[model samples]
Target: SQTIHQWPATLVQPVGSPLSLECTVEGTSNPNLYWYRQAAGRGLQLLFYSVGIGQISSEVPQNLSASRPQDRQFILSSKKLLLSDSGFYLCAWTNRETIYEQYFGPGTRLTVT
Candidate 1:
């Protein structure tokens, strides 16, 4: 079975600090990776996506950035955190063969104070 993992399941930080979140997948190759954020009581917003190594697409206008450092590994990072950046961050994966299907990790809830 395939699995996706996200680390530091929860985080709380003050304004203006750096942030780094990691996501990785097992049992799959060349999978499409995606980063999403959901505000409290709001729908999910697609932040960034990678179809392959070094191939990333931003879905919206946001300060967040995503990178595929290696196959099966995607990283989301920010040089400085913003209060509005606080949200539930999720990492999801899907393959070209199963474009309609996606698997998501438990997610990381971030709070900026």
Candidate 2:
């Protein structure tokens, strides 16, 4: 069975600080990883996607970036943050052999003040 995990379930930061959020997937190989964000009362927005290591696609253009250091690990980072960048960040993965069914992590809720 595969599982996805995210850290810092909740975060509070002042504007202009750096940010790093991580996600890891277990029990799968060569899966397609994704990063998403959902603002309060809004639909999920795709931020980034990785088909493999060193191959990342960005769906949203912001002050954020993602990296896949290992087969099962994905990291999201920001050099400097803004108040408008606050939201619930989620990580997900879909197995290529599983008909593209995605499984998501618990998520990281961030608030910038």
7-43, model 2: which lDDT tens digit per residue?
9899998899999999999999999999999999999
> What's the lDDT for candidate 2?
0.94
Model 1 ranges off by over 4 Å = none
**Candidate 1 per-residue C-alpha lDDT over 26-75 given as tens digits, one digit per residue, 9 for 90 to 100:** 99999999999999999989999999999999988767788998989999
lDDT on C-alpha atoms for all candidate structures:
0.93, 0.94
lDDT value for model 1: 0.93
Looking at candidate 1, what is the lDDT of residue 89?
96
Which numbered prediction scores highest in lDDT against the true structure? Answer: 2
- Cα lDDT, model 1, residue 96: 80
Evaluated at residue 82, the lDDT of candidate 2 is 95
